[model samples]
Target: MIDFWLAAGLLLLVALSFLLIPVLRSRRAQLEEDRTALNVALYQERVAELQTQQEEGVLDAAQMDAGRAEAARELLADTEGVAAPRVTRLGKPAPLLAAILVPVLGLGLYLHFGASDKVELTREFSQAPKSMEEMTQRLERAVAAQPDSAEALYFLGRTYMTQDRPADAAKIFERTVNLAGRQPELLGQWAQAQYFADGKKWSDKVQALTDEALKADPKEVTSLGLLGIAAFEAERYQDAIDYWNRLLEQLPADDKSRIALQGGITRATEKLVASGGQVVKAPVAKATALLKVSVDLAPDLKAKVQPGDSVFIFARATNGPPAPLAAKRLTVADLPATVELSDADAMMPQLKLSNFPEVQLVARISRAGKPTAGEWIGRSQPLASSTTAPQTLTIDSPDK
Candidate 1:
């Protein structure tokens, strides 16, 4: 901020110079004009003295004329190289007034419209925040600086949720939805916040938000998690377990949150069993098959794809239905990514990798965000699903 102000001050001085330099030059020109006038007056005075002497018979006409000529030469010598005074329609006061107003007007306009607050926020965020409160303050300032910024609003809403200010979080999330569109993740966040903001009671608005989110993406993690929490709070242990199981399927095996989620599922199961409700176990394969594949865009096809294009990697039985048994979705930016597909990643509960003996691996890049249809694709020859070696897949051929 010190440096910022110093630079601003330097610019103001530069502006002031434009207004002040002309006034200073005019003053010097005025002094030269005065000096020239004084020389002329002295020359006139000397001529008058010579004429008086001639009229008093102390000098002849020739002597008077010579004396007058000598005075004229002296006047010219004294005034030599002096410039004519500059003509100015506006007086000194005008330039002085402008000098004063220029800076004041500039400062006023900058204060009213400049991004000084945003600049300060940027500086503040460059360092790790000392505390949650400090972070919240910075986020608040950021949202204030850019009210239309949906990203800032989303982060601020999340921060409010972290601080347990659900009412504020709900309002901020609503604003975020309006600015960023009803994205599945944002809708789920809004529903969760709104549910808590209403004193932990579910409302029609919350229900609608969650429904819309889940309809768009059945595996939306936030919506699944929120629904599970709502069911647990309402004492519907079975529903909680079901919702949590669905979310568990969407999570990667190595996800950090899996442990906590599993614990929640365990609690819900205990409650169900204690209430005399029989818990049915999902069928588990005796030998789970895991296929590790590294996917990448071919160098020749790189120029034909966008970074945000969807990439779908899957395995389907070579002699079975076209539907993928296990699949993972990513963006082209995540290409050159190594992904593991197992029964846990099955598209349907009935479809599992262990059920298939021989499978073909496929990787496709789709600009239209579709998994089934794409512009470029790659495929691996039939291999045992239980193969332990990691296979490399490159999207180099046109999809047919």
Candidate 2:
């Protein structure tokens, strides 16, 4: 019952504040200006009262001293007609106002102009099959416009997988591989989809695709990574190291890639050591020629240069004829192409002429199907004999 009274009193006081607040604020301001006069008058009255009480033997001198000290330090207790709190209204807390306003504006602006509703769609995609169906239908329309679109089919499968529609995605992936012929990244995606669909079961097709990818391009980094994992799973320690080494070679020698590469290498190397096997290296070839190259373009470089555009770069060799990569026949369609010397376009390897020996370097950039520009960087070496051994050329050293 007391608690109820207290709560009711608090609410009543709050309800009365709206009518009393402005007047109370004005009175407080007036009190600040007139406080000294009022205090002095009160002190005078207290001194007179103390004297009267002392005369009647009520308060002693010590009590009077304490009273005066307290009177000097504090305002007198409020009486019935005492002025209310004063001052030109209190200042609002700017930080509190900003805290409320900031979120309102930020969320309002973000929804109005910042992010698309599509971002949410991707997040809750599993709940919305209709959106996925529409996306697939749109992709079908696009593929119909271009019958030979391998990339489109690949994208379609990826969309279906993202929506957790595995069966539909599997069909699309199967079709994409047939159209594109062979793509390592696409194959990886297909295998990954199957693994996810079957609760992480490994299929023979996965292994076959990985092998074919590595054969298609020795520098296929992702294939090398898959091969490394497979080799480790099979307890082929040296084979794992060889595959990881290929991946390491293709990675940039920066702090990020260096740390990851070294970590993988360390793992494989440790396993190889435990098995008493050596990590395999590329066979070294003996020759007395070299080529130097400086890249002027990067793969996936989104510049003004587009597909079917002419591209150019400079190269040099140290020994023989730069016959194969004619400067005028270079083009851009040969993606991820290396600069090496060639005799009538028959490509061969070479060293950097310092720490390694073996050179037959040529430089060429192709546009569509024809070479648009090229230049030999060093003296070329004539091909003497074909062998499995190819020397590792050091591209790190600059002419010093």
Candidate 3:
């Protein structure tokens, strides 16, 4: 900040030179005009004395003429090479006043509108932060300096969440979403923070956020993990297991979190079995054949769609490429429809649904007939490809 001020001051001096230099030059010109006038006055006095002496017969005409000529020559020599004074329409006071106000007004305008605070923030961030608290403070300051910056707000919100200040984190995340749009990762973060901020209680708003996030990208890890935590807190062991399992599928094989998450899934499964819930052990992937799924548009979104819109039902490997392994297409009019996905429907011989251990079922309504992107979407939790139960997937959220 001090360096910034110093640079500003130096620029101000440069600007002042433009105004003050002219004023100083004008003063010098005025002094030259005065000096010229003084020399002319002395010449006139000497001429008057010579003429008086000639008229009184104390000097001859030639002598007087010679004296007058010499005096005229001296006056010409003294005034030689002096410039004609420049005319200033605004007068001396105006330029002097401008010289004083230029720096002052410039500073006032810069303070009100310039990006000095942002410059300071950039400088501060260049250095490594000493602690989490220091980093959080820097992020907060950055957000303050650039209120419309979605990236700054995102980092600040994440820092708040890490500090256990979920209420503040939730608000910051909300602002970020407003600026950056309803991106899946941001929505998932907002949902997680809002859930914790509300004392870990589930609400329709949080549910809606998580649903929208997962619909846009079914493998959204944050939403999956948050849902698992919420289900566990509500004592819905089976739900906890399903959500955790979905989240686990998104993790890498070497991720350290996978061990902890697997432990969580095991605990949830044990609780479910203890509470008289049926636990089915899925068969090996090579033995899996067909998966029957029921896809439907949500009632609230029914009016927002057209009957001719294409509904794409697909199964994708949880840990493989984004391309669907097996797919089926239908019109919106045929929704509330049942579909079967199997190795026979695979886009390629080597990408069969049975080849993957777990798959996510997606039902998307694309008005443009593109299967990869759509207006509305629904997704199922990661499930074994061998599961024979009819899966239900609802198109209840915006595609992104």
For 1-400, candidate 1 gives per-residue lDDT tens digits of 9999999999999989999999999988999999999999999899999989998999999999999999999999999999987788998999999999998998899999998898898999999999999999999989998999999999999999999999999999999999999999999999999999999897899999999999998878999999999999999998898899989977877789989999999999999999999777666535479999999988988888888999999999998888999999999888789999998898876567887789999998888988899999999999999998999998999998
RMSD per candidate (Å) reads 11.0, 21.6, 13.3
Q: Estimate each model's TM-score.
A: 0.71, 0.35, 0.67
lDDT of 3 by residue, 118-230 (tens): 88889989999999999998998998888999999999999999899999999999999999999999999999999989998999999999999999988789999999988
Residue range 45-146, candidate 2, lDDT tens digits: 877887788778888889877876776555454333565543343343443455456556755786688634444334444354466678776666656655
**Candidate 1: count of backbone clashes, pairs at least 3 residues apart or interchain:** 0
lDDT of 1: 0.92
Q: Highest TM-score among the candidates is held by which one? A: 1
Alpha-carbon lDDT, every model? 0.92, 0.55, 0.90
Lowest summed lDDT across 10 adjacent residues in model 2 is found at: 391-400
Clash pairs for candidate 3: none
What lDDT score is found at residue 325 in candidate 3?
A: 91
In model 3, the number of clashes is 0
Deviation from native of the Cα of residue 101 in model 3, angstroms: 1.6
Off by over 4 Å in 2: 1-149, 156-170, 191-202, 254-258, 274-400
